[model samples]
Target chain A: EPEVTQTPSHQVTQMGQEVILRCVPISNHLYFYWYRQILGQKVEFLVSFYNNEISEKSEIFDDQFSVERPDGSNFTLKIRSTKLEDSAMYFCASRGPTEIHYEQYFGPGTRLTVT
Target chain B: SQQGEEDPQALSIQEGENATMNCSYKTSINNLQWYRQNSGRGLVHLILIRSNEREKHSGRLRVTLDTSKKSSSLLITASRAADTASYFCATYVMGFQKLVFGTGTRLLVSP
Candidate 1:
């Protein structure tokens, strides 16, 4: 079965540096999303994208965060500046074209560690 | 006590036993989904139950949704040690495009 795949399984960066987490969602899926989970915390939604634009975002997805579909298959999340609290497992997910009652397939996730 | 919360945060059982996890949500949802995550790894989709449906089953996994009560349960029967993982319930709320995830239940199935 086709699955969502992410690059740089583990990333380490300085507190003030920028980092880009990349994902290649299933080729035919229509909706893409980004979520994060702090160690021992529930998965939190960051942003959702569709039709080449952001559909919705959470408070945590402030100015520092941006997502883009730079290419047909690549969906990336860029953090302008990383904070210690930003360290977490970032996951990318994609859902099929069906309008409703579809499950989102998740990638293995990129573990971001900011020091 | 957030949008989605799972009860009995941790559960332990032996192989061949059954495991049940429950989830409660605060708002009206379009659908409820169950996912599993191994230690420090990615999440794997398990099953999905729509708000309009009362129950769904896939393999040995069974899920039931009670829209009126805003609750859902996931049951894994005749489980194996490989079933040991953290299980989470995610809700796609009405009018929202994002999925809200629960705190998750860590299941440890010993051999």
Candidate 2:
């Protein structure tokens, strides 16, 4: 089955450096999302992208965070200045055209470590 | 906060036994979904029960949703050692377009 894939399975960055997490959602998917899991905690939604614009975002997704679909298959999340709290597993997910059922496919996730 | 809570922070069962996890949500939702995550890995979609539907089954997995009570349960029967993982319930809201995940139930099926 086709699945969402993310690049840089693991990353280590300085506290004030920039990091870009990349994902390639399923080719036909229209809705894309970014979420983070802090260590063993529950997953938290960051932002959702559809129709080339942000549909919704959480308070956790502040000015430091931005998402871009620079190409047809590539969706990227960039953090301007990483904080210690930014060390977490960042996941990328995608869903098909239907909006009601809301079934999503998640990628393996990129583990971001800020020091 | 994405509105769902799960209990039994951890559970242990032997292979061939059954495992059940429960989830409770605070508000109305379009559907409730169950997902599994291995240690330090991404999530895998398991099952979805719509607010209008009462129960659903896939393989040895069964899910029931009680919209009126705002709770749901997932049962895994005749489980295997490989079933050891953290199970999460996510609540889906309409126009907000988000899936808020619960704390999750960690199941350890020993061989």
Candidate 3:
């Protein structure tokens, strides 16, 4: 089965530094999303993308956060200034272009450690 | 927060035992989905039950959704050690446009 893939399984960055998490969603998927999970916490939605634009976002997705589909295959989340609270497991997910009804396939996730 | 809440935050059972997890939510949803996550890993989709469906099953996993009650349950029968993972219930918001996941139930199936 085709699955979403993310790069840099682990990321360590200094506080206030910029970080961009990359994801390659399933080739035919039309909806892409980014979510985060704090250690021992439930997953939180960050943003959703379709047609090269963000469809909806949460308060957690502030000015410091931006998403881009630089290419047809790559969806990336960029944090302009990282903070200690920003450290979490960031997961990329994709859905659609299948017969299954409304299921998002998640990637292995990138563990972001902000020090 | 429109997040779902799961009960029995942690459970431990021996192999061949049945494990059941329950979830409740506070909002109207289009569907409910269950996912599993190994320690520090990503989520694995388990099964989904639409708001219109009362129950659905896949393999040893069974999911039930009560739209009127705004609750769902996941049951794993004759589970194995490999089934030990954190199970989460996610609700679809805005007609499948977004998902709100709940605090998961961590199950440990001992061999």
Candidate 4:
């Protein structure tokens, strides 16, 4: 079964530093998303991307965050300046044909730790 | 601020026993999905039940949706030790692609 893949399984950065998380969604998927899970907490939606534009974003996805599909296969989330509270596990997900009730496939996730 | 919330923060059972988790949402949804995540890993899609559908099944997993009550339940029968994981319920609100996830139920199955 094809699955979403993300790079940099774990990252540690200092406060005020920048970090880029990359994901390669399933080849045929049309919709992509980014979510974060603060240690032992519920998963929180950050942003959704479709057709090279942001479809919707949660309040957690503020000015510090931005997502881009720079190529047909690569989708990335960039954090301008990391903060201690920003430490969490970031997951990338994708789904095919938004009209149908298809399940979203999630990647293994990148553990972001800010000091 | 959480749209979906699950009950019984944690559960434990024997290998052959059954496990059930419940989720409640605050608003109307297009569809509800259940996912499982092993320790420190990504989520795996388990099942999806639309608002119009009352019940759905896949192998040993059964999912029931009660849109009128804004609640849903997931049942896993004859579970194995490997089935131990955190289960989450996510709701896709109407007119959008975002999915709001609930606090997960942590299941620990002993062999």
Candidate 5:
């Protein structure tokens, strides 16, 4: 089974620095999403993308956050200026056509630690 | 602030025992999904139940959705140590493209 892949499984950056989390969704999947989970908290949706554009976003996805499909295979989430609260497990997910119904496959996730 | 909330934040059971977790949501939804996450690992999709569906099953896992009450439950039968993980219930609210996940239930299946 093809899985979503993310780079830099663990990232450590200084506060106020810019960081981009990269993901390579399944080749054929059309819908891509980014979600984050604070330690011991529920996973929160950040943004959803389709056709290389944002379909929807949450309040957490403020001006500091941006997503890009720079290439056919790469979907990235960029934080213009990091904060301590930005430290969390960021996950990338993709969905493709399925016979039963649609389902999003999640990647292993990138643990972002901002200090 | 709109999100699903799971009950019994944590559970512990022995191998071969059955584990049950419950979830409740505040809004109408198109579908409900369950996911599992191991410690320090990413989430794994377990199952999804549409709003119109009452129940669904996969392997040892069973999920039931009651739209009237806006609640769902996940049951894991004949559990094993490997089944120990954090289980989350996510709801896809109507007219939205993103999912809102609950706080999750951490289960520890002891060998």
Candidate 6:
């Protein structure tokens, strides 16, 4: 089965530095999303994208965060400045067309570690 | 205490036994979904129960939704050791495009 895939399975960056987490969602899916999980915490929604534009975002997705679909298959989340609290597992997910929008396929996730 | 919360943060069972986890939400939802995640791995979609549906089954997994009570349950019958993982219930809240995940219930099935 086709699955969402993310690059840089593990990323380590210095505090105040920038980092980009990339994902290639399942082809043919129309909606894409980004979520993050702090160690031992619930998975929190960051943002959703459709038609190459942001559909919705959470408070945690402040100015520091931005998402881009620079190409047909690549969806990326960029954090301008990282903080210690920013360290977490960032997951990328995609949902099928309208008929199957309820089910989302998730990628293996990129573990971001900011020191 | 949040939008989505699951009871019994951890559960232990033996092979061939059954496991059930309950999840509660605070708001109306378009649909509720169950997902499983092995340690350090990606989430695997299990089942999704729509707001209008009372119950749904896929293989050994069963999911029930009670929109009136804002609660849902996931049951794995005759579970195997491979069934051990953290189970999470996520809600696609009404009028929202994103999914809100609940604190997961970790299951450990010994062979």
Q: Which number leads on lDDT?
A: 1
Task: Write the residue-wise lDDT of candidate 1 on A12-109 in tens digits.
Answer: 99999999999999999999999999999999999999999999999999999999999999999999999999999999999977666378999999
Docking outcome class, model 2: high
Prediction 1 TM-score vs. true: 0.98
- Pairwise lDDT winner, candidates 1 and 2: 1
Off by over 4 Å in 5: A98-101
Model 1 sits at a Cα RMSD from the real structure of 0.8
Candidate 4 vs candidate 5: the lDDT winner is 4
- Per-residue accuracy of model 5 over A1-115 as CA lDDT, tens digit each: 7999998899999999999999999998889999999998889999999887999999999999999999999999999999999999999999875423457799999999999
Looking at model 5, residue A75 earns an lDDT score of 98
Clashes of each: 0, 0, 0, 0, 0, 0
Quality of model 2 by C-alpha lDDT: 0.94
lDDT of each: 0.95, 0.94, 0.93, 0.94, 0.93, 0.94
Worst 10 residues of 5 chain A by lDDT: A95-104
How well is each residue in B17-106 modelled by candidate 1, as lDDT tens digits? 999999999999999999999999999999988888999999999999998889999999999999999999999999999889999999
By DockQ: ranked, best first? 4, 2, 6, 1, 5, 3
Model 4 chain B worst lDDT run, 10 consecutive residues: B1-10
Instruction: Quote the lDDT for A81 in model 3.
Output: 99
Worst 10 residues of 3 chain B by lDDT: B91-100
DockQ metric, candidate 5: 0.91
| lDDT of candidate 5 over B1-111, digit per residue (tens) | 347889789999999999999999999999999999999899999999999999999999999999999999999999999999999999988888888999999999999
lDDT of 6 by residue, B5-104 (tens): 9987999999999999999999989999999999988889999999999999999998988988999999999989999999999999989998999999
- The digit string of per-residue lDDT tens for model 3 on A28-97 reads 9999999999998899999999888999999999999999999989999999999999999999999988
- For each candidate, give its TM-score against the true structure: 0.98, 0.98, 0.97, 0.98, 0.97, 0.98
Query: What digit string (tens of lDDT, one per residue) describes model 2 on residues A1-115?
Result: 9999999999999999999999999998899999999998899999999999999999999999999999999999999999999999999999986665388999999999999
Interface RMSD of each: 0.6, 0.5, 1.1, 0.6, 0.6, 0.5
Residues B55-98, candidate 2: write the lDDT tens digits.
99999999999988889999999999999999999989655789
* Candidate 6 chain A: 10-residue stretch with minimal lDDT: A95-104
